[model samples]
Target chain A: MIEVFFQYDFLRYSLFTGLLIGLLAPLIGVFIVVRRLSLMADALSHITLTGIAFSLLLGRHINFFAGMNPVYMGMIFAVSGSVMIEKLRHTYRFYKELAIPIILSAGIGIGVVFISLADGFTTDLFSYLFGSVVAISRTDFIVVLLLTSVVAILLFLFYKELFFLSFDEEQAVISGIPRRSLHLMFIVIVAVVIGLSMQIVGILLVSALMTLPVAAAMRLAGSFKQMFLYAVIIGEVSVLSGLFTAFHMDLAPGGMIVVINVVILLFVLAFTSKK
Target chain B: MQTNNPSHILEMDNVHFSYAHQPVLEDINMKVSPGSFLGLVGPNGSGKSTLMKLLLGLLTADRGDVKLFGEPVKSFKQWSKVGFVSQKANSFNSGFPATVFEVVSMGMYGKVGLFRFLKKHHKQKVREAIAQVGMEEYMYQNIGKLSGGQQQRVFIARALVSEPDLLILDEPTVGVDAQSVTNFYEMLKELNVHKGITLILVTHDIGAMSDYVTDVACLNKCIHFHGNKETFEANREEMMTAMYGHDVSVIEHNHAHDHHDHSHDHDDLAGTRS
Candidate 1:
């Protein structure tokens, strides 16, 4: 692993970025898991793909024609899509589950449209669908860093509110936690995290990164704080090891990271599960 | 009835609520004075729980007003000041990582507000609250690991942690062991007497309510009766007759009346120890 890190600047960036995501991903993953919104993470991640493909299609157009970073546009689109899912879910009370499929299909629909419209920009959609850790650019790293900060800061600032809400939503409501606002903000934060993570873990397995560690941790932890600690430890180790092996074997790091999480999940399930 | 009796903590005026236009509560009216233990009792589907929701603003009243501390319940900003324990005390995030202490700490969220974390005093409050419910032994235990009785106590502890002016508990003793139910009411009585916190307990067991509550309100989609404990005992036959919809449990009521035989004795019921 040290050798891999010392070998190439890209590898170093891969490990650095991977380590940071390992910490932040699972930290947020704990909240996502507790709130039972792990599936929403998957839906939002895929939605981000449409935004990413559009960014790819219009990178040159953005720089020369539009005078904007495609990343910024992509972020806006991804965040907006996340916000839309929240609105749709909330606005349609009787059809709460409908939001996921609607967002999922809309994303795929937009991706298909953008792919057709892009003409010749990055035809290898499989890479984005799955994951390629090496695909993370310097700009992508910056975005991930900013995203990690946003997630960490917001999570810290709203720690009590989110914890109370996630544990017992009705109690939180009775306590006047501004359920509507925090709920909207939660979806947006999830979108931002999913957007950045899609580059490495890919849309396909990003939710796994968000869910598996927390599930495993629940078996061992006695309280919310302990569960978070356990999840962070599990998540960080899995991603760092996966990133290293993926680099050495010349494979996609994101897929490897998720596979690593699944394998550990299985290990924990076998040992800890009562049934 | 007591020295700690302050102004009314809750006042409901012609409160009417329904689900999908099917009436669950009809023209309900009640008031819970501070430092009093009021039991909202009725059979199943009698809207005891619904009345609690209306008081907490958890459910909207379609045709009346629920005021908290003389203000509209909807406009109550200091919600944590009125603690709540829904009937489904165990129906929370069972898999979430949180101890009895943490769950109780969350009860302070309203008073602590956003951006402000729990300070040392908050920790002390949590510690005191958990101990108040006789759950200090399980302070660090995961809430999911506790039995039904223990879980209910933890919820009570969570409610108490807020140091509320009023505590509203809906069927909180359900699913708990018999001993726990007795213990829980005793704790509530202590809080109402010693700490001077108003407690509104919603339960189907009017008999159990008689054990501790200072006042009683019977409901069957509406208030069958609402007044002081002496009035409840004085009208025991009516409460029994009204609740059973004829007369089946009259023996138990007679037994209690005969056993206490102190309806007019004032101090006997008021100072009865659990």
Candidate 2:
């Protein structure tokens, strides 16, 4: 683990990026989970797959200008796709499952078209699909860092209002918190975190990182502050352990991290529920 | 009943609102002075909370105007001038994790800003609000661990943390224990007598109105009765008959008014600087 930390800068960058994601993913996850928007995060992450594929299919061109960092295009598509999802969910009179079909089919449709066009499905596209330790570029590292700072600063500045809204949007608004502004801010933050974390954890595994630590922490912490602290700590531990295990086993870092989170959750639930 | 003073804290002029073309509240013309405790009594879905929502600028009125402290409600930017504790439906009980102190301190969000980096003065104000609500013992305890009444008290503390001229509580006593209900009213009465904060108490508790509320407004999709405590005391039968529209029952539990003479030091928020 120490050797993995010291020998290569990419791994160091990966570790730092992982830690940043560790704190933020779960922090935002608390809102998604509370607002009963848990599935929206899932839908949003899968939508990132479309962007990931497009960045790669058009990878030969976009990367010609800015290197192989897929995040810029990834974020653009993620935010746009999320906006679409919002529109679909809001506009359609059908069930929320209807929005899922629209977003899911659109994401999968775009992803399939891009992947088939790229002709790099099995071998070259594994980084975007699974997780790639080698793909954590310096630019990706910087993007992750910038995104982490933005998410953290937003959360800190709006902690009380966010808490009130997450707990009770109706009451928070009645107390004069800007309802539309706060809700939009939360959605944008969720998109940014999911997009950046996709480089390391893959879109498939990121929401688990975002949500699991919070679920586990809620069972143990006596207050909301402690829950937040414990969630960050647990997120850090999962990311670090997963990165180290992936290095040793020659496995994908995202899968390893999610596994570590699941193990931690199981242990915590068993311990706390026993008490 | 001489209407001499033009210094009403809250006023609604012919307010009209509807949901999907169905009228909910129409022509709500009421004026409340500073330091008066007006209780909104109504059956379920009678627009009690909706009127409070209008007061706080949550729901826009379809027509008419809402004025806060003589200024238009829409024009009042700094919400700290009006403290509000919404109904208990907003409370987080299933998976809530907040200490009483943290939850109460959240009330100061408007005044102290969103961040928790409070100065000493802000800290003292938070503590004072918590103590005012008789929640000092559980200040450090997790809010989810407390009883329903204790949680409501924490919310009241939070609302008061900003210390506005008008404090609006939407059914603050419902679902709480009987002992806590009386205790909650006592605390409210103390705040009214000492701080002279204009209060709007929305509840269904008919018997407890005289003890805490200076005025009562019974709502049944419309204003069945809007008048003073003395009038309610005088026309109990008529008011109940109008409220229920039939042979409505009233278990006249006597609530003493003698305990409202307590003293304290407060003008409540910055708007009531007298």
Candidate 3:
């Protein structure tokens, strides 16, 4: 396995990006789970799918855009979708979560149209939808790296603000924490993570990568710091083990990683129940 | 009554608020003098929470001026001197994985600002706040594992850690047990008296809170009565009339009321107040 990882640059790229996503997803996921906005991630990922489909459709028709990475377009849609979610939630304050389904349906609707117009589902689209280990190119790895750096800096700078908001939103507002700006920044970060992570975890299963580790950590962690530590550890372990299994068995890494996360969540639930 | 006093920490004049054209608060005028414990009692839909939100700048009043620390709320940048604990403080996620210290430290986040880490003094202040609420032993305990009363105390500590001059709590004792509610009131009293912290508490248990607060304001979409607790107790019939919009019987609990007897007293008061 070690020899295979060293022999294949694609394998190295997949493992490296997976490790970073494993760390970054749950780091953001802690806030998502704590704020009860887990489904917002699913909504954003679907929106990314639309952007990918749109980019693919454009790639086939336009010579200038033929070789462009769909991931860039996906990020644009994800970020805009996040802003739209914020706007819709503001517009319909009483039914805030309604923003999720509205975006989700629009994403699916537009994505289907784009896919059909792009001459049906191809292997490239399949890689974007269900994830392919070899689908991650050198540029994709660089994009993930840049995103991971941005996320790290923002998290470091705004850790307390994010934590404060997640723990008690009303208090955060009353304390004059620039709640609107910080909230917008947070969801955008969530959007970016969702967009970049789908390259490895697949659009369908990205939220699991973001949430499952945090869910497990919530059961065992005694403090917020411990929760982060436990979540990242769980995420890394799941991804590494999943990738190893997928490589050995020649299965899809996205499904394998998510299944591992589910097993971990079940194990934590069963074990923690005794306490 | 002391509307012209510059010492008022919180002032709302002719404040009118509504939701979708239905008036929630109408012609409301209120003032909080420094170092006074003001208990705001009102029935459901009486706009107690809305009024607090207006003061906290969480909601914009449809009409009128809201001044905090002598500045209009829009420009009231000295938020470190004001702390708030909502009614849902005790109703937050029970499984939220945060330690008591972490929860308390959140109080300083606003004052500490962004991009900077908490200093040692800030951590010490968090410790002091936890100790102030008598939760030092649970500083490392998960906040979710604590009882509702303890969680309420942690929230109070969170509010106090900032050392705010004006502390606003909205129905803070909703889910707390009877025994702890008494202690909660005592803690508020100590904070008010010793720290000179102006307090505005919104609650439904007027009878229980009436015994602890220095001033009382009875409301039902309007300020029916605003006076000292003694005056409020003396004019119970009129205050009850103002609270419920009709002649209502009010049970005034004597000083000898014990924890077990509170239910009887509360029931009698709830019957009238609601």
Candidate 4:
């Protein structure tokens, strides 16, 4: 496997992206799960799916988009959708969760239109939807690398504020932490994570990559820091093992990765329940 | 208008707030002076939480001026000096995977400022706060594993970690046992007297808190009476009727010597803040 990675650039790129996503997904997932905004990730992933489909449709028609990667459009759409979700949640204050379904439906609605117009899932679209180990371009790797770095840096800078808001929003507000901007920043980060993660985990299974490791970590983690550390470890393990298994079996890495996470979740649940 | 008086920590003058078309607070005027332990008591919908929100700038008042630390709320930037423990403390994500030390350290985050790391002194302050609230033994314990009263104490420690001049607690003893409630009040009293921290406690138990607080305010859409504890105890009936409105059946229990004044007329207590 080590020799193979060294020989083939595609293998190296896929492995590198997989490891980075493994870290970034669970890092953001810890906050999402703690804030009870797990559904928001699902909604944003759907929105990214719409972006991917639309980009694929544009790739066929427009000369400019002909050579463009769908991940860029997916990120743009996901970030905008996250901002829109924040606005809509504020508009319907008492019915905040209503925003999730609204965006999810819009995403699916737009996605269906784009997929139909594109004459169905092309080879390109299928690779994005379910993820392909060999399909990751050098540009996608850089984009993921850059996004992961930005997210990690932002998290480090605002670590205390994020924990404060997630732990007790009212206290955060009273402490004058600029909570609205922080929360908006958080959702945008979640959106970008979902968008960037799709290249490795696929649009359909990105939220699982973002959430499942954290779910498993929560069972025995003693503290927030421990939960964060444990989640990243769990995520890295699943991604590496899933990638190896997918390489051997010629299967979708997305499905393999998510199944690995589900197995870990079940094991943790059973193990913790008995203790 | 901003008051130049250094003693007055909070001032809400003619503050009127409403939710949508329904009025929650009307023509409210109140001031919290420094080093005063104020017990804010009212019926369920009397806007105790709303008033706290206004002071904390969580909700902007539709019409009125709210000044904190002698600065207009819009311009007040010294949040580190004002600690607030909201009603949501008890209901905060119970499964949130954080230790007591982490939670207490969050209090100093504001004072520590942004884009900066907590220094050794900050950790020492967190430890000092944990010790202050007598939760030193549980510093490493997961917050979720603590009992309701113990969790409440950790929250108080979080509030005290910053060493704020004014500590605002909105029903801090909601799920705490009776003995713990007494201890919590005693802690607040000690915080007020020894540390000179101004305290505002919002709770439904007016009679129970009357003996502990230095001042009392009866709130029901408006400030019916705001005076010292002696005046509140002396004019209990009038304040009770002003709070509950028109019909209130006051009964003295067998342990009347304990000053347990029970008012069993809360039927008209909901949605009448307008």
Candidate 5:
């Protein structure tokens, strides 16, 4: 297992990307879960899928797009979707949650149109939908690394403000914590994370990677900080073991990772309920 | 427009606010002096919260000047000098994974500024704030595990942690028990008198808080009465009828018996108006 990294660059890239996603996903997930915005991740990921499909369709016709990574387009779409969600939330102040489903439906609707226009269901699309352990390119690995670093640094700088906002937004606004900018930064980062995680965990399972570990950790941890730590640990373990098992069993890495996450959540629920 | 007086902690002049064209507050003029505990008493839909929101810069007044600490609220940047605790029991998410210590530490976030970590002294201040509210023993305990009154105390401690010149509490004792409510008032009085933190308490039960506040303001779509506690007490009966638009008596109950159903009375009054 140790020498396998020396043999194949794609395997090595997959492992590193999986580990980084493991850390980044749950770190953002903690705040999302605490703020009860878990569905926001799903909406953003669906939008990312729309972006990827559009990019693929363009690549089929244009030489320039053929050379470009679809992840960049996916990120652009996800960020735009996030901005729209924020706008719709303000438009329908009384029904803020309405924004999520509207965006989710738009994403899937446009994504299907793009898929059908591009002649539908290629091996490339299947790999993007369910994730392949051997499909992570060096560029994807580098992009994930850069995104993970940026996210980590931003979180460290704005940890307290983010925590305060997540805990009570009204008080945070009253305290003059620059609510609008902070919220925009948070949602944009979440969008980018979802956009990138699509490479390691498929679009369908991306939200599970972002949410399941946090769900399990929420029941066991006593404080917000503890929950954050426990979630990251759970995420890393699931990602690593799932990738290893998938590599050996010739299974989709995303399916294995999400299954491991569910098993962990069930175990934690059972353990906590017994006490 | 009147020039902002630096001595006043808050000033709202001819402040008019509305929600979707329905007027909530109209021609509200009030000034909160430094080092004065002012009790803002009003009925359920009397715009007390909306007024507070205007002062806090959460909502822009449709027509007037609102200033905080000698600066217009729109341009006011020094938030560390002001603390606020809203109706915590009703609005708070019980399942939020935070300890009393973690929650209190949030108060220092604004003071500590952006891009900076909580240092050793910041931790000491957090612990001191918890101790001040007599919640030191439960500092590490999850906030959800505490009773409603205990949670309220923690929120007050959160406000206190900033050492603000002014602390505004909106209906802080709504769901608290009578005995704990008494202690809460005592703690607030100590903060006002001993610590010299200016206080603005918004409540339906002015009878409970009248003993603690130095001044009283009766608000119902406007400033019905804003004066010292002595003057307000002297005119209590006449003002209550005028402000509430009904003949009502305020029962200053003894805390020992704990028989006063303040919330019940509030609901009855609100039910009548609707």
Candidate 6:
């Protein structure tokens, strides 16, 4: 495996991308889970699929779009979808979770329309849907690195504000935290992370990467800080092991990674339930 | 046309609030002096929480002026001087993964501002706040594992961590046990009398809080009575009956000693009122 990574640039790129996504996913996931916004991630990932599919369809006709990275379009759509979800949540205040399914269904519905319009699925689309370890280009790797750095910096800057908001939103607002702007910025970041993660975990399983590690950590962690630390550790372990297994077995990395996350979660559940 | 009075910690004048066109608070005027423990007692749906929210600038009043620490609430940027613990604080998710220390430290985040880390002095303040509430032993303990009363104390510590000049609690003892509730009031009294933190405690059970609060205000969509504790005690029955919109018998009990028999007295009061 070490020799393979040294020889193959694609393998090295995938490994680096996988590690970055691993760190980013659960770092954001802790806030999502604690705020009961787990399904928002799933909804945002589906919307990212809409963006990717729309870009693919546009590329078929437009010469300018043909050379553009589909991930950029995916991010734009994801951020828009996040904002729409926030608006919808306010529109249906009593039924805030209703925003998730509404956006999710719209996303998949529009995504399928674009896919069909583009003359059905291709090999490229298949690689994106299930995640291909060898398909990650150098450009994709750089993009992932840039996004991960941006996310890390933002999280570090607003760590206390985010934690306070997640713990008690009403009190945080009362304490003079700019609740509306922070909420909008947080959701936009979540959407962008989902967009970038599609290459590593695929759209369908992206939310699992964000949620599963945090779920396992929550069962065992004594404090929020511990939960955050354990979640990142769990995420890194799952990604690294999943990549190795996928390379040896010729399986989809996304499926393998999510499976490992599930295994860890189940193991934690079993361990904690006894006490 | 009212001037900002430097002596009042909170002042609301000609305040009118309506929810979806239904009036909640109307033509309300009240002032809370510095270092006064004011107990805001009202029946359910009497706009007590709304009034508190308006004072905290969480909810905008439909019409009127609200001043905090001699500044208009809209322009008041010194939020560190005002701390609020909502009624919902007691009913928060128990599974929230936070220790007492972490929860208390959050109170200082506002004062620390954006793009800055909490310094060593902030940590010391957090420790001091936890000690003030006598939760030093539970500093590292998960907030969820503690009892309701203990959790309430931790929240109080969180509020005190910032060392606010004014502290407002909305039904902080909702699910607290009898003995713990007594201790909670005593701790609050100590904060008010000794620490000189002005308090506005919102509760429906005026009888329970009468011994601790320096003043009492009864609300029913408006300020029915706002006076010193002596005047409130003198007019307790008349005020209770008027604010509740029915006949209510006031049963005076010292919360510290007779809390066990307090429920029986409540049952008797209910029987008479009905």
Better of 2 and 5 by TM-score: 5
List, residue by residue over B63-151, the lDDT tens digit for candidate 2.
99998877788876767877888776545655677778877776776666544566788889999989988889998888777788888
Off by over 4 Å in 1: A59-74, A119-124, B1-6, B248-266, B271-274
Instruction: Note the clash tally of each candidate.
Output: 4, 2, 0, 0, 0, 0
Q: What docking class should model 2 receive?
A: acceptable
Deviating ranges (above 4 Å) for candidate 2: A60-66, A92-101, B1-6, B89-91, B114-116, B250-274
lDDT of each: 0.78, 0.77, 0.87, 0.86, 0.88, 0.89
Please give, for residues B1-274, the per-residue lDDT of candidate 3 as tens digits: 2323457898889999999999999999988888788999988889998998899887998999999988899877878888888888988887888899999999999999878899999999999999999999999999988999999999999999999989999999888887888899989977877787889999877766865677888878989888766677678778777687665434344333553555354344334322
Query: Superposing all C-alpha atoms, what RMSD in Å does each candidate have to the true structure?
Result: 3.4, 4.8, 4.8, 5.3, 5.5, 4.9
Which digits, one per residue and each the tens of the lDDT, describe model 4 over residues A1-275?
A: 54675578998899899999999999999999989899999999999989988888898899888788888899889999999999999999999999999999999999999999989867877778888788677887998899899999999999999998988877887787889888989999998898778888888899998899999999979899999998999999999988888887889999999999999999999999997
Give a tens-digit lDDT track for model 6, residues B19-131: 99999999999999888889998988999989998998888999999999888899888899998888899888999989999999999999999999999999999999999
- The candidate that achieves the highest lDDT relative to the unseen native structure: 6
Report the C-alpha lDDT of model 4 over B162-231, residue by residue, as the tens digit.
Answer: 8899999988888889899879877987898789888999987764576567778889888888977667
Name the TM-score of chain A in model 6. 0.97
Predicted candidate 5 versus true structure: per-residue lDDT over B35-112, tens digit per residue: 788999999999998998888888899999998888899998878889999985446888888999999999999999
Model 2: DockQ against the native?
A: 0.45
Which docking class does model 1 fall in? medium
Candidate 5 lDDT, A20-65, residue by residue in tens: 9899999999998987889999999999989999999999999899
lDDT of 4: 0.86
Residue B254 C-alpha lDDT in model 4: 22
True contacts kept of 6: 0.84
Give TM-scores of the second chain, every candidate. Answer: 0.88, 0.86, 0.89, 0.90, 0.89, 0.90
**lDDT, model 1, position A165:** 85
lDDT of 5 at A156: 86
